[model samples]
Target: MDEVITAADASITGSKSSIIPYNLPLLSAFLSCALAQFLKLFTTWYKEKRWESRRMLSSGGMPSSHSSTVTALAVAIGFQDGTGGSTFAIAVVLACVVMYDATGVRLHAGRQAELLNQIVCELPPEHPVSSVRPLRDSLGHTPLQVFAGAVLGCIVAYLMSSS
Candidate 1:
């Protein structure tokens, strides 16, 4: 009869574990972020009718990469560990904080940057501020963007977990 190796036994025996099994949650989160960023590029191309490679690296777009990453981590944790587990709880709280910051504080900060840039643009050309580069106007996501990212994260995590 074949012996069944439990997780604890396998660990104590120093058996090598596959990377995917050991790091599925982290992999899910990273993949979610990458997917969201890639989608941003397409979304921008679709709406603006111009391809912007910067969208692949920039923050604040149709879907929130930050939200997608954290939400995927949370959902992945919930799947691997029970939803009621402490790890899942921590993941959930972290996700909430990130999503809130993306949609609220960071969003407002981006707006403030836009206003500041506008003010700087109105200044005299000789002014020191006028010579400085404008603050990045797209630094955070809208609520709808965050929501879409959350949904995408959950879906990705669930699909990854099932496999």
Candidate 2:
């Protein structure tokens, strides 16, 4: 009886050890976001003619980090669990929703912010509202930016999964 119990304990421990140490989908998503954010730095430098490290931490850039993250997660799930699986289906749905939000609602909000900032700039200096900080005008990405992010995410996930 003791021998049987000891063998069972060893088997459980061995099985635990054999389990994957990292969640591949999650890692792929995070890495995709990080890469997108990092790339923003270079894009900003190119367009502004000056390096701006803050772009790495800011939202709404040349490539949408939100799109990259969701796309990467979906692609990773598809690669690991098969495109026909329910998990992959869910990931696809989520990615679509996120991409839509980035290009639709958030894009509109960014435009509104720009307009509001312009209005604020015209206000008198002594106006109480004029003393407030300007709204952020880069809260979302263009359609092209979203597409670029999605492509980058897919590439990243594919490379990670293939290896």
Candidate 3:
């Protein structure tokens, strides 16, 4: 663990002793996303009263992984390049777009899928649509989830920068 951290520090300084190259922005983004997804396991268990290991790889959970990823990247870029740079501006725009889509279009689409699934289940067996598979209903996040993800991502970026 210490060695890995040393390597990361070395990488930032462009030191010859670095065991491997590491980019703080990329690392922050990935770690934030992974932590958000991993946290879904506990969140799901709290809400559903069951342990679901698959939540680590699933979407539409308490904290939005998509939001976490983008937010971390944006915050890290801002820290590295300064908020006034074109790179930081681009990153912030991208994060906003992604987070908005997650809560807006994707959330509504998931709700629609849930309604469609209910309708499909009620259809008569002879109906052509009765045999169709149900659409996935867990495809987006709530505003709270997005907010939590953003917070988590910001924390990750801060931690990475301090390291």
User: Would you list the clashing residue pairs of candidate 1?
Assistant: none
What ranges in model 3 sit over 4 Å off?
1-20
Candidate number with the higher TM-score (1 or 2): 2
Compared with the true structure, what per-residue lDDT tens digits does model 3 show for residues 1-163? 3545565686677745566656888999999999999999999999999999988987798999999999999999989888999988888999999999999999999999999999999999999999998998899899999999999999999999998
Candidate 1 wrongly placed segments (more than 4 Å)? 1-21
TM-score of each: 0.87, 0.88, 0.88
Candidates' lDDT values, in order?
0.91, 0.92, 0.92
RMSD of each: 4.7, 3.2, 6.0
lDDT of 2: 0.92
TM-score: which is higher, 1 or 3?
3
> Which residue pairs of candidate 2 clash?
none
For residues 88-130, what per-residue lDDT tens digits would candidate 2 score against the true structure? 9999999999999999999999999999999999999999999
- The list of candidate 2 runs beyond 4 A from truth reads 1-20
